[model samples]
Target: MTSSTEPSLYAPREPVFPRRVSGPFRRLKWWIMAVTLGIYYLTPWLRWERGPSLPDQAVLVDLAHRRFYFFWIEIWPHEFYFVAGLLIMAGLGLFLFTSALGRVWCGYACPQTVWTDLFILVERWIEGDRNARVKLWKAKWNLRKWRLRMTKWIVWLLIAMATGGAWVFYFTDAPSLARDLVSFSAHPVAYGTIAVLTATTFVFGGFMREQVCIYMCPWPRIQAAMMDDDTLTVAYRDWRGEPRGKKRDGTTGDCIDCMACVNVCPMGIDIRDGQQMECITCALCIDACDDVMDRIGKPRGLIDYLALSDEPVERAGAAPKPIWKHVLRPRTILYTTLWSLVGVGLLYALFIRSDIGLTVSPVRNPTYVTQSDGSIRNIYDVRLRNQLGEARVFRLSVSSDSLLRIDLQGIPDGSDVTVPADSTHLQRVYVTAGPDDAAASTDVSDLRLWVEDLATGDRASRATTFNGKGN
Candidate 1:
């Protein structure tokens, strides 16, 4: 009992079988895909010799030890600001690229795009090209159809599994994890992560494909704000190709109505329909249209990269502005400056950072303990972090306006504490003030706890409050 004029809230997805075409853009995409996939799969296996005690994996997120190691750089839990700065830089870089060349990240280097391209390559291999795939899709299920589908699915599953496997390798020692995985002795969490990633990759890349870009990804919606009139994007020249007709009569437009652009589109959307959110700016349509134009003895660029501001100039049959004009504009320049500043800041911070770390937490339950010798004592838990490759002796010292004495519980001399290499050690510290001292009679006193590495003479300090008995 549905009315014929009623709107349908849901529409079934139309399958897209993109025809293979070779041009500059297509070749560029092939190179990007190969390089990106190679990096993703092989980066975890690369070894970096850190030390005898440290892991040799070049890039690892050691969740067990709360550390992130990338080549020679190591990040500890306390230094999370470094991670935040990198993420900010990444965001700014995305903004810079999107402002200069719209959605270039999504088109060229996005993980989804790379994986989807790989899945399509496999699909085109097992089945035939676009025409063959379309026919096979519409035809009844037979033994040949079953065999082709099964073959494609099996290959897709393998790729997805490998993708998942490569991801987990980044979290731990790759060789050890691989051995554990093979022997079925790895943690259940690892298996769960792999299974989840494999399923998502297979479904998103092979089945969902462009749907992920069109509906699932928020970047498509957010990219509009990041772009302006000067942002270069994939576009069709409706002005030149309008009145859609072949070159039969001398007065007809350039378009032949061959639908070549539509046939090669991975999103199954026509480029001639003008800019749409579904367009990833992949420039595949540009390649397709250029091929058609060359065959028909017409000039290329029936569909190509164009900025909105340059459309008027192009429409008037004049040369458009230079590429640098569009890319080096105010908005892009601002983003670039910000990105550079962040990068430089992070580099400066990394280089100037100290290897020694100190944390002081005062035990406040019994704020001040009065000793039998008429002295005020405060307890502190001091954690010393040794970032060097080997163990070193760290000497403790206390400084204040008033007379204060520092003592370590276990150390005989109460002066030196030895922390293991690349590790933190917690030591109990006692600060005592004689009854006649001004700090012992005051309510609160400023205290500085310092730890100096005896080997390197490098020092770190923590400023803390020393509780005192009120007069």
Candidate 2:
């Protein structure tokens, strides 16, 4: 129905087969992949001794009880500001790293990159490297091809399942969850989350790969804002690489146009075409180009980790700038300062936080109950939180306002109120104003409710008001 002049918005996917190459950058990528994947698949299994009152898992999100435990630190719902501070620091950290090193996190630590590299390793192992993969793609369908394809897919499925399972472990006790998963006894939500994550991992890692970096991720679009002239990124030195051909016949510059860099690039971009948004700056092209340069008996770094600021300098015949010259500029300094301040504030708060907490809510249905002795009484709901691992007795007092006297509903005047380990105790409290004070005071009296741990002397307080009538 459309006119021929209208161009199609969708472009068909062209599969890329990245060639295997050996150089320093390639070795660095291998180490990064190993460490990142190891941390992801193994962290949930780490244990910490938090006593019997809490889970021993070093990192856990106990959603049912509204607690987040990270090793020695346990966070309550009221202290969520600590989590917010951490999130802010994470954002600033990203900005700092992005400004300093172009897409380094994307290349090294991102789960997508790590998993995609793993999938590619499997593919190369089964289907052979770059050239063989290209040939197989064009080859006719047969038993040999189908067998290899099935084997690769099965291996990918196992990895995806493991990835999903590791994520679910963060929300519960890992060993128990593993047992429950095998026995089909886990909660429906757990199973649903695992299933969904498994599907996404399989699709994203095994099939999508670099398409995720190019079209799916928003980081590439925003990364340009983080870059400056002095920011280091993988680059092709066209000054040395241009006028391309082999060297022996006196027909070329240093670059032979052998296409080694293009073949090894996972994003399928020509680094020689200048910087493109599609480049992940993974440095694989640098490895490929350097390998080719070495073979051709030319100085390496035809494609290297260099900065745009150096390009003009090199062209003008000036000495190259030092590596750390512009790295500590205003932007990075501001980011680092902000990140450090939040971390320090959170640490201070954690160190000074008390093990006892108190909250009070006034009951308003009757407002005031006139006592038989002509005194005024107000009912309140008091909640006492015990953060320690052992049960303790807490004494409640309400003496800030001279006219207000406090009493708990169920307990006799002299009895102790006991709070269980890591739990809250709720009591209906009464505030009474004697006839003398009620007769002389205003309609409302502001009062303070304080709770002290009888065993440890830890204390906290909340302020409230007592209703009364004055002449």
Highest TM-score against the true fold, candidate: 1
lDDT of 1 by residue, 1-471 (tens): 346898777888999999998899999999999898999999999999988989999999999999899999999988899999999999999999999999999989999999998999999999999999999999899999999999999999999999999999999999999999999999999999999999999999999999999889999888999999999999989988887886668676788888888988888999899888898888998998999999989999989999999999988989999989999998998999999999999999999988888789999989989999999999999988887778989999999999899899988676999899899999999999999999999999999999888877988898999888988
Which lDDT tens digits does candidate 2 get at residues 205-324?
988988899889998888889889877888888877778876567666788989999998888889999888888888998888888878878899999878889898876878678778
Clashing residue pairs for model 2: none
The residue-level lDDT of candidate 2 at 464 comes to 83
Strongest candidate by lDDT? 1
User: How far is 180's C-alpha from truth in model 2 (Å)?
Assistant: 1.5
Clashing pairs in 1: none
Once fitted onto the true fold, the runs of candidate 2 whose alpha carbons sit more than 4 angstroms away are 1-7, 248-251, 364-367, 401-403, 438-440
Instruction: State how far residue 286 of model 2 sits from its true place (Å).
Output: 1.3
- Give the Cα-based TM-score of candidate 2 against the true structure: 0.94
